[model samples]
Target chain A: MNRSTGFAFIAPLLVLMVVAFNLPIIYMLGLAFWDKGRGFTLEHYEGLLEAPVYLRVLGNTLRISLIATIANVAIGYPLAHWMRGLGRRARLIAIALVVLPFWVSILVRTYAWIVVLGNGGLVNRSLQWLGLTDAPVQFLYNELGVTIGMANVLLPFLVLPLFAAMIRIDDRLLQAAASLGAPPRTIFWKVYFPLTLPALAAGTLLVFILCLGFYVTPAVLGGGRVPMISNLLDTLINQIPRWEQASAISTILLIVALVIFAGYRRLDRKASA
Target chain B: MTSTPWSRRLLAAAGIFGLVFLTVPLLIVIPMSFSPARALTFPPPGFSLRWYQALFGDPRWMEAMSTSTIVAVLSSVAALVLGSLAAYGLRRGSFAGRDWAEGNFMSPLIVPTIIVAIALYLSLAKVGLLGSFVGLVAAHTVLNVPLVMMVMGVAVRDFDLRIEQVAWSLGASWSYTVIKVMLPNLAPSVFAAWIFAFIGSFDEVIVTSFIAGKYETVPKKMFNELILEVNPTITAVATLLIAVTVLALAAVTLVLGRAGKLGQTLVER
Candidate 1:
C-alpha cells in the first residue's frame, strides 16, 4: 500500500489511541501547574517537595520497591536455576503453578495473606500451638505485610523471564563447562550466572517498576496506615480531593517509573548486543 | 557427583515448597469458605455450605458476574477482530515504518496499567462515556489487543506464504484462500489469544476500579465488600474463581499438548 493509504487505514486506531490514552496523561501533566484553577502555577510541585508527608511517602515507595525487587530477584534466580533442569512436563506444571496467582485478583491474594499472617492467623496460631509464643503476634498492616504481599504478587513476573532465559541456554554448554575442569561453583559463577544476568536484570527492573505503582496490595494489607505513594494518592483523591497535589505526585511517580524503565530497556539492549 | 545428590534434593525441596506456597492460599481459602465458624480461621470446627448458598442466593453477585461476563466476552471478540486484522496486515504487508507501527501497538503492554486506567477514565468521563458498557468494552479491547498481536504474531511467524499463493494461482479468491488455507492453522493461536484477552479483562482491577464508576464488576464488588465487611461470601467468590482458573488452565494444557506435538513435528524438518 502507498504511504497515504497506509496512514488512512491505520489513522482511526491511531486517533482513538491518542484521544483515549495519551490525552489524560498530558492533562495530568497540565494539572500539576494549577493555582486554584485561575492560572497555571507550580505550587503543587512546591507543596509536594515541601510537604513532609509527600516526601515520606515517596521514600517509602522507593524503599519498599527496592526491597521487593531484591527479594524477588534473590528468590527468582535459584528457582529459575532449578526449573532449568526439570523435564518438560514438570517445567510446564511449575510455570502454570507460578503464574496461577497472577491470574487471580491481587485483592484476593492480599486478603489471603492477611488470613495467613494476621493476629490469630496461621503463623501465630501455629506458633502458639507449638508453645513458641505466649501471645498472638501482629504481622498484618505493616511493612512486613506490604513486602510479603507485593513480593507474592510480583514473583511470577520475575520468574517468567528468568525461566524463559534459562530454557534458552544450551544444556551441552553446561556439560562442556563441567568437562573443562571447572568446579560446579566456578561453572555457575563464571558461566551460567553471567548468561542469566540479562534476564535477572530485566526481571528485577520489571518487578521494581511494578512494585513502585502497587496500590491495592498496600491499601488492603497496610490497613491505610503504612503509606506509599499510591496509598497517599488514593487518600489525596478520595479523602481530601486534592486533585492538584494528587496530579503532581502522580506525575512525579509516572516520570520516575518511565525513566527507570527506559534506562533498563537501554541496558537490556546493550547487554543483549 | 557428590554435589549432585545434595543439589538435586535441595532443588526438589525448593520446587515443592514453591508449589505449595503458590497453591495453598487458594486451597486453604476455598475450604475455609465452608467453615461453620463465623470468623475466618485456618481449621474449621465443622463444615457448611452457607457461603456458597449465600453467593448463589445473592442477586448482587449474580448481577456483577453477568456484567463481568458480558464485558469480557464483548471485549475479547473486539480484540480478536482488530488485533487479527492488524496482525495480518503487518505480517503480509511490508512497509517503511513496520517496526514503528508494531511498537506503537505494543506500547500499551509496556506502559503501567494505572496510567492507562487514569488516562482512559479522564477521557471517558469528559465525553460522558464513563461507566457505559461501550466504554468498558472499548477500553478493555485496546488493552487486550497487544496480547492478541503477540500470540498471533507467533502463530503466523513461520507460516509458509507460498501455500496461500498456490491456492490463489488455482483461482481461489483472497478471502477463500485465507479461510481455507490459513485460518485452520491460526485457530489455536486465535483461541489462545481469546483466552488471554478474556482473563486479562476478567482479572483486571486497576482499570475497572477507576472506570466502573457507579457500576460494579465482580472484582469491584468483591473489593468493596472485602473492605467494608469481611464475609464468607468473598471466600466463596474466591473459591469459584479458583475453580474457573483450574478449568481454564486444563483447557490451556490440552491446547499446549497439541501445540507442543505440532511444534516438535515442524522442528524436525
Candidate 2:
C-alpha cells in the first residue's frame, strides 16, 4: 500500500480520537488551571489542600489500593505458580475461572460481595454456624469490604499475565538447578521466582493503578462510608458542583497513573523479552 | 519443582482456594437469582423464576434493556469498522509516527476509566451534548475502540500480505480486494472483535452513569438500584449478564479456535 492510502485507512479513527478522546482530556486539564475571570490560577489545588476531607480521601484511596495490590500478589502468585504445574485441561479451567469474572460487569461482582458479606450472607452464616462468632461480622459498608472487593475484582489483572509468563518458563531451567544439587525450595526461590519477578512487578503495578481509580466497587461495597478519590471526584462534580477541584484531582491522578504505567511498560517489555 | 509432595499439596490447596474465592460470588448469584424468597439466602426455600419475571415484566427494565442493546449494537459496529481499518493501516503502513498513533489509540484502555468518565462528562456538558444519545454512542465507541484494535491488530499482522498483493496485481481495486479477499480471511477475528466491543459497551456503567443523564442502560440501572438498596431483581439481571458473557465468549472461542488464533488472542496480550 502507498503511504497516502495507509494514512487514509487510519484517517477516520484518528479524527474521531483527536476530537473525542484527546481533546476532552486536554480540555479537562485546561479547566483545572484556568479561572473564569483571572486567566489562570492554582486555586482549585489550593482548595484540595485546605480541606481535611480531601486528604482523608486521598489517604483512604492509597491505603486501599496498596492493600488490594498486595492481596492480589499474595493470592495471584501462588495461583499462577500452581497453574504452571497443572495438566492441560486443569490449566484451561483455571484460566476460564479467572477470565470469566474479568469479562463480567464490575457492578455485578461488587454487588455479589454484598450478598456474600451481608449480615445474613454466606461467610457470616458459616462463621456463626461454626461457633466462631455469636453474631454476624460487619463486612459491608466499610474499609474491609471495600478492600476485599477490590482485591477480588483485580486478581485476574495480576494473575493472567503472571500465569502467561509462568507458562513460558522452560522447565529445563528448574531441572538444571535441581541437577546442580539445589533443593526444590532453592530451585523455586532462586530460579523460578526470579524469572517471574518482572511479570509479577508489572502485573502488581497494573492492579494498583486500577485500584486507585476504582469507583463502582467502593461505591457499592463501601456504601458511601469509604470515600476513594473517584467517589470524591463524583461528589465534587455532581453533588456540590465543584468542577475545578474535581479537575485538579483528576489531573493529579492521571499524571500519577501515567507515570506508574511507564514503569509497568518497561517491566512488561523485559518480562516478554 | 513438583517433587515435594507436602509442598505440592499446600500449593494445590491455596490454588483451589484462590479459584473458589474468584468464582464463588458468581456461583452464589446464579443460585440466588432462582430463589423463591426475597432474602439473599443461598439455599433457597424453593426454585422459582420470580426475579426473572420481575426483570422481564417491568417496563423500565425493558426500556433499559433496549437502550443498552441499541447503544451496544451501534457503538460496537462503529468500533469494528473504524478500528479494523486503523489496525490494517497501522500494521501495513510505514508511517513516520505509526507507533505513536497506535499508542494514542490504545490510551483509553490505559487511562483510568473514571478519568475518562469525568473528562467526557465535563467536555460534553460544556458543548451541550452531555445527555444526547449521539454523545453517549460516541463515548462508547471511543471506549470500545481499543478492544477492537487489539484483536484486529493481531489478525491484520498475522494475515499474509501476498494474497492482497496478488489481487492488486490482477487489476482488482483496493476496495474490491479488501471486500473479496481480506474480509473473508479476517472474518473470525472480525466476529471476535465485534463481540468484545459489544459486551464492552453493554456492560459499561461508569461512563454511562455520568453522561447518560436520564437514560438508563441495564448496568446503569442495576448500579443505581444497588446503591439505594439490594433488590433480588438485580440477581436476575446479574445472572443474565453472566449468561450473555459466557455465550459471547464461547462463540468467540469457537470461531477463533477454528481459525487457530484462540491461544494467541487470549494469552499473548
Candidate 3:
C-alpha cells in the first residue's frame, strides 16, 4: 500500500478525534487562560488560590489518594506474591477473581461498599456478632469508607502488573540462591524484592494516578462529607457553573497526570525490559 | 527458595484475605439483590424477585435502559470500525507522524476522565449541543476508541502483512483483500474489541453524567439514586450490570483464549 493510503485509512479517525477530543481540550485550555475581554489572564488560577475551598479539596484529594494507594500496595503486593506461588489451576482462578472486578463498573464496585460497610451491613454485623464491639461501627460516608472503597476498586490495577512481574522472575534464580545458602527471607528480600521493584513502582504510580482522578467511589462512599478534587470539580462545573475555574483546575490536573504518566511510562519500559 | 511453614501459612492467609476483600462486596450484592424485604440486609428472610420486579416495572428505569443500550450499541460499533481501520493503517503504513497519531488516539484513555468530561461539557455547551443525543453518542465513541484500538492494534500487528500482499498480487483489490483475507483472520479480535467497547460505553458514568443533560443512562440514574438514597431497586440494577459484565467478559475470554491472544491482551497493558 502507498503511504497516502495509510494516511487515508487514518484520516477519518483523525478528523473525529480532532473535532471531538482535541479541540475541546484546547478550548478548555483557552477558557482557563484566555478571558473574553482580557485576552490572556491567570485570573481563574488566581481565583483558585484565593479560595481556601480549592486548597482544602486539593489537600483532601492528595491525602485520600495517598492512603488509597498505600492500601493498594499493602493488599496487592502480598496478593500478587501469593498468586505467583500458587499452582496452575489455582493461579487461573486467582487471576479471574482479580480481573473480574477490574472489568466491572466502578459504580457497581463503589456501591457494593455501601452494602458491605454500612452500619447494619456485614462487617459491622460480624463485628457485633463476634462481640468485638458493643455497637455497629460507622464505615459509610467517611474518609475511611472512601479509602477502603478506592483501595478495593483499584487493587487489581496494582496486583495484575505486580503478579505478571513476579511470575516472570526465574525460579532457577531462587534455587540458585538457596543452593548458595541464602535463607528464604534473605532471598526474598535481597533478590526477589529488587527484581520486582521496577514493576511495583510502575504499578504503584499507575494506581496513584488513577486514585488521584477517582470520582465515583469518593462521591458514593464519601457521601459529600469528604470532598476530593473530582467532587470539587463536579461542584464547579455542574452545580456552581464556574466553567473557567473548573477549566483551570482541570488544566493543573491534566498536567500533573501527564507528568506522572510520563514517569509511569519510563518505569513500565524498565519493568518490561 | 522455600519459606518457613509458618511464614508460608501467613502469606496464604493474607492472600486469601486480599482476594476476599476484593470480591466479597460483589458476592454480597448478588444475593442481596434477591432479598424479599426493602431494606439492604444480608441473608434475606426469604428469596424473592421483588427488586428485579421493581427495576423492570419502573418506566423511568425502562427508559434509562433503552437509552443506555442505544448509546452503547451505536458508539461501540462506531469505535470498532474507525479504530480498526486506523489500527490497520498504523501497523501497515509507513506514514509520517504515525506514532504521534496513535498516541493522540489513545490519549482519551490516559487523560483523567473528569477532565474529558469537563472539556466536553464546556465545549458542547458553547456549541449548544450539551445534553444532545448526538453529543452523547460522540462522547461515548471517543471514550471507547482506545479500547477498540488497543485490541485491534495488537491483532493487526500480529497478522502477517505477507498474506495481504499475496492477496494483492493475485489481482484482488485492496478492499477485496481486506474484506476477504484480513476480516477472516481478525474476526475473533473484532468480536473482543466490540465487546470491550460496548462494556466501556455502557458502564461509563463520569462523562455521561457531565454532558448528558436530562438524559439518564442506567449508570447515571443508578449513581443519582445511590447518592440520594439506598434503594433496593438499585440492587437489582447492580446485579444486572454484574451479569452483563460477567457474560461479556466470558465471551471475550473464550474467543480471545481460542485465538491465543488473551494473555497478551490482558497483561501487556
Cα-based lDDT at residue B213, candidate 3: 96
Order the candidate numbers by TM-score, best to worst: 2, 3, 1
Q: How many pairs of residues collide in each model? A: 0, 0, 0
True contacts kept of each: 0.26, 0.79, 0.83
Candidate 1 per-residue lDDT over residues A75-126, each given as its tens digit: 6777777777888889767777887776777777877887788676787899
RMSD of each: 3.2, 0.8, 1.0
lDDT of 1 at A10: 50
Query: What are the runs in model 1 whose C-alpha is more than 4 Å off?
Result: A1-12, A33-41, A267-273, B1-4, B261-269
**Residue A67 Cα positional deviation in candidate 1, in Å, after optimal superposition:** 1.3
* Poorest 10 consecutive residues by lDDT, candidate 1 chain B: B260-269
Per-model lDDT: 0.76, 0.94, 0.94
| Residues B1-269, model 3: lDDT tens digits | 54689899989999999999999999999999999988777876789999898888999999999999999999999999999999999988998999999999999988999999999999999999999999999999999999999999999999998899999899999989989999988999999999999999999999999999999999999999999999988888999999999999999999989989899888876
| Predicted structure 1: clash tally | 0
Cα interface RMSD of each candidate: 3.0, 0.8, 1.0
* TM-score of every candidate's chain A: 0.93, 0.99, 0.98
| DockQ of candidate 3 (2 decimals) | 0.84
- Model 2 clashes, total count: 0
